[model samples]
Target: MDFSLLKEAMESNSFEKIADICDQLMLQVSAQGIKFEEDWPYTIHLLGHLYVNDVNSARFLWKTIPSVVKEKQPEVVAVWKIGQQLWMRNYSGVHEAIRGFDWSPQTQGLITAFSELYTNKMFHLLLSAYSTITVGDTALFLGMSEENATNYALQRGWTIDSVSGMLTVKKQPIVTEQKLDPSKLQRLTEYVFHLEH
Candidate 1:
């Protein structure tokens, strides 16, 4: 199947459409055989799983990634690494993997989306671990400026102790998403190509 469909679906920014397409591609991969050849469809499907914070589904896809694919697209492996770190609540590791991510020039857009998704998820994971953290510390851990961190904390209703610079994590849920334009689909495809051997 042509990636044009996945491209269009991803550009839609609707997780439902992306996931539906991913499921369709997964079925195709099963029928067509996941093999020694390039399987961009399968890879894109895994990306959709990540986009939706579906780590379990993404892990299932990881089991199918050929070793050849692993060697070529370390980003695929990086995806796993990022997920593992998240699972372990190893924000530091997630931070290292995501920040040091040498994204292929072609994937800048798709990577941007993935980066945002992972970053947001990681921040919440950190909150789950710590009930109270210093504002500066939270900012550093979140990779945001102190001011931005304070603003985010305020927005999230996280308690702030101005005198102590402490930001307390309140049990509130929120998602902050700023989607990119759909025009980057081609670049996302080109990026997957770069990951190819």
Candidate 2:
């Protein structure tokens, strides 16, 4: 959506806001009834991308996986298995990149900027799943107000009308929320969002 706003959020190290935005977006997708499998390659790619801010690398991993697997079909199962192995291999590269990056105090700003980009790009992929997401949901996903989400969407060249159209094609909901301990959230936020900052 609003790359500028996202940039600002990251640069400011606003983890709570970012988490809120992500949650809102997830809620919107859930509301649309488009399900995402827990072990889906897309989910893995999303996490990897967020962790490393590398879309091309994430894409490479995602493309390696096969579309289907059959329990009774040995050949099909093998292909899918190989795909997963390759995907995991490539995913390790993202981890390596993060480790290799020169993240010093001065470069903290840059890390935050890229982190925001990674988060926003992930959100874009999620939005693409449903035709039209609600303004409220979108705002919540971005951790902004409805007006902000709409403005951000417009700036990104997405139209409300198109989002509405996508919502019409109902799919089974795959995403769900489990109650996470506050300590875990704090730890994640500290390590993932605030570490470099």
Best by TM-score: 1
Question: For model 1, what is the C-alpha lDDT against the true structure?
Answer: 0.70
lDDT tens digits by residue: candidate 1, 1-197: 56677777667655445656877766776698764346564445666676776778778778877778888877777667766766676655666666776766544556577767666775787678888888777776676778987887788778788798888888756788988866798788789999994
**Candidate 2: count of backbone clashes, pairs at least 3 residues apart or interchain:** 16
lDDT of 2 by residue, 1-197 (tens): 22344345556765335433433554565688866433222332233343443434445544543454233323323222323433564432332343344444533453455445644753565456766677766654554556766777777666666545222223335898899799998898889877688
Model 2, position 159: C-alpha lDDT score:
68
- Local distance difference test values of all predictions, in order: 0.70, 0.47
Give the Cα error of residue 79 in candidate 2, in Å: 38
TM-scores for all candidates? 0.65, 0.29
Query: Which ten-residue region of model 1 has the weakest summed lDDT?
Result: 35-44
* Residue 43 lDDT (model 1): 49
